[model samples]
Target: MHSVIETPMYLRAAKAAGMNDAEMKAVVDHLSMAPDDGALMEGTGGARKLRAAGRGKGKSGGYRIVTYYCGKDVPVFLLDIYSKGDKTNLTKAERSTLREILAEVANAWRESARRKAQELRRNDHD
Candidate 1:
């Protein structure tokens, strides 16, 4: 199973957002540990429902949480931290960036499995 990972930047940002380290840790911790919440994860591959509030706006009136799900087996939904004042609600640029990031994460796991599959193939050939 994949392990949960967090960044120093996110730690500080979460704190600034009023979420303490413990709270942040708790969120990242249950990422895979907890059952599927409202949505599975649109980024993985499936239907989605963006937060009706449109994630609101930040100091510059352009920042908010973008919630979505990818697919069924995703296990957990992806939460994107960005701004809504950019273009449109859940616009292409936003989706593109989110897709790239999600793809990177998924690609890592796929790469590991691919290596294992190749090893099995070599063994069979031998």
Candidate 2:
């Protein structure tokens, strides 16, 4: 299973959307099994949106989870969440913000992996 990282924004949003621990766990579990299940959201710089069913609420009236998955090496990041009643789509400004955030997240993950690899190589030589 791919690891799942919940960003602060997502946590806050989930709480505001009234997602219980069980519901949250289910969402994480689903994403861990299928990290690429969500549809790619254009203009969000690789962000994908997954519809999560809430308690008694089918997907039609469920929550939207914004996520970013770099690859197998990197964990899937839950960027944001919102109830369907909150809003239908992201605003232009929100998309622009998400684009920048996604880029930075990808870059930082790559850099972290590179540093870890370098450290491992150095340790091997010792």
Give per-residue CA lDDT, model 1, range 4-103, as digits (tens).
4344544444445554456455455555453233343344333233222222342345334333333333334335443344433455565567667666
Reference-based lDDT, each prediction: 0.45, 0.92
lDDT of 2: 0.92
- Residue range with the least summed lDDT across 10 consecutive positions in model 2: 101-110
Highest TM-score against the true fold, candidate: 2
Question: What TM-score, to 2 decimals, does candidate 2 have?
Answer: 0.91
Which one is best on lDDT? 2
In model 1, the runs with Cα more than 4 Å from the true position are 7-9, 38-92, 112-126
lDDT of model 1 at position 125:
100
Model 1, residue 50: displacement in angstroms?
11
Model 1, position 19: C-alpha lDDT score: 46
